[model samples]
Target: NKARMSAAGIVGFALEAAPRTTRAQSMDVLSSQANIAGYKAVLVAAHHYQRFMPMLMTAAGTVKAARVLILGAGVAGLQAIATAKRLGAVIEASDVRPAVKEQIESLGGKFLDVPFVTDEEREIAQGVGGYARPMPPDWMRRQAELVHERAKAADIVITTALIPGRQAPVLLKEETVKAMKPGSVVVDLAAAQGGNCPLTVADEVVERHGVTLIGHTNLAGMVAADASALYARNVLDFLKLIIDKEGKLAIDMKDDIVAACLMTKSREPELTS
Candidate 1:
């Protein structure tokens, strides 16, 4: 696809090209869409879940608050934590990046700490480019053990772990789904990329071992209006990087964002202006 575009003398910009930094944050389409997806994931899970999210006390009986487990503490995961908390759910989240522990706590979600025993594990857990790098096999095994235990107690689980351009990590195994309580819901935001839960089917809601697995690839599309608004703003902000003050289309290759977004390896003559 890139070769075809370059062969046709077309200069293209990647919408998700902006680095996750304070200066270029407004132009980050990934973050914008993820924010909406995270918010929607909780709502979707609540809709499918038979039990109440918040606890209630009455003369007849008292209901316990739902336990929600979130895998991944990126933009989507953090937003999911906040949304679930608002509905009075007890949220616990896990991520390879230890840096997100504070963010999860700030949003009223408990951080599931997977201790790094080895120096190599600790270095890899730091991740790269604001995204999680694939952890060592030993570390992943440890995380899986922890997640399995947590999933059994959770009424709702949302998995958002994904490594860019790679298959999504499998956090929740098949056994974990089977161990979850009856009528539990698992929302896999990483469904498009094979999912964090092995049971998830992309764009389908399936029932396995009495657990509902929501594998909607495009959660942002579920709340289309707001998602579109946010995306359009991101596009507009990105346009400013390529358009000059005089209203002329100016592609400045020197600009960090512009350079990062350039898809064609070779510069196109038409874009030189």
Candidate 2:
């Protein structure tokens, strides 16, 4: 049976049976890893522009602090905000989830709110998992307008909004990118999943109307060795529950977490290029 099952199949089964970790524990681990990526993304942006992140009190003149705007309040966004704050950049963040406001504020980052009157309060009170439920079309339009206004004022914008198993919501439009200040940078963390910026091309950094749009795919993979080790540990810990005393595989199909994470259907029958 072991020989019959492919390595990929075994790994997939192991992940499904992995021991459950509390949200707090998972967030802690994810944050630690994301912080490193956030710091590096900023450094990469700065190097690309040949600009200093910190203000210089040189004999010539004083340099202004860079302004960094992070969209989304998940692990990646929060880390980006913290990293930007540490580098002396003014950090701002936005999220559909109202609960994240406190999380952003706790890190000394300002939360940008879109004034859309809705039952978000009631929804938040209910405590839904992951992100707030998707907003109505009108609300999304209003939010986009507000975000676009804010994006124009930011020197660097990092977009990290992602909906599990779904394409990332479009946050920054092409016109918004064009409206940004010359030499401004926009990093889209959702590039791998179709991106949050209309102009973003996955894994490529291209200048659009003078603004730099960086659509980085698999940003975590940039730090491969560490990322791999952390991922391996997560996999190994989960695998312990699926493997018995003799290291034989056992699968429980009824587990909620397992059922939720499993890929159900294939979009196409076969690979085509």
Candidate 3:
């Protein structure tokens, strides 16, 4: 008998597959979600400030455009840059990966470049797929200094640097936040992973040296129902590939990607008569 025909009915199965999507693919979805958060974060920040986002050429006087700084040119950061730019804010962004410079520029955001030499072999080995490699302490210090310098000049800063399964690297120190203009806002997207800013406390807004540090956790979960639906669909699509037509579990262990990502311990042992 064929594998599918012999096997008994299986109601459901789970696999630990790394969502089968590239950075580009994930970015497509993340951009949509982050755009909402980006726009909302700006609006939330604006409410706390005395000025407006758009310049007013009214009878009173000319209002200046808000200076918006985005740290880490990842999907969320790029979306934040674009959203802030559209809202009539001058957007500036920075990233450890120099490759993101063009991406930021394409979205009408200025990319702040910080010079650093990367080891090619080390970069390649540490980089799994398209993800960035972890940097040494020396490189991190240089990057932090550059971010601190630029952050002081901006009225608003949104940080989005994050690494999967690791603590988010600190990009903005407390000293830098203190130097920011009074009433300035910092939204740290890495709050759940210890934040990119020193003052960030997940899900709470705190004031430090006259600057508002927002460390809201699960920015995606802010729009819970929508996020849940999208994530569920992604999971369902991946599962379809592993289940047979009869709906019995048939994992192909020889497949490296499947083997590497699947969580075997989570599954209950099959009870057969």
Best by lDDT: 1
Any runs in candidate 3 off by more than 4 Å, and if so which? 1-40, 117-127, 255-257, 266-273
Give per-residue CA lDDT, model 2, range 107-210, as digits (tens): 98999887557675445423345544566777688878888899999888898887755798899998888789899998888888899998899989898988
lDDT per prediction?
0.92, 0.71, 0.71
Candidate 2 TM-score, C-alpha based:
0.81
The lDDT, on a scale of 0 to 1, for candidate 2 is 0.71
After superposition, which runs of candidate 2 have C-alpha atoms over 4 Å from their true positions?
1-11, 14-36, 120-128, 253-255, 258-273
TM-score of 3: 0.80
lDDT for 35 in candidate 3 is: 52
lDDT for model 3 comes to: 0.71
Candidate 1 structure quality by residue, lDDT tens digits, 66-103: 99999999999999999999999999999999999999
- TM-scores of all candidate predictions against the true structure: 0.96, 0.81, 0.80
Give one digit per residue, the lDDT tens place, for model 3 in 148-193: 8888888889888777678998888988988888989889888888
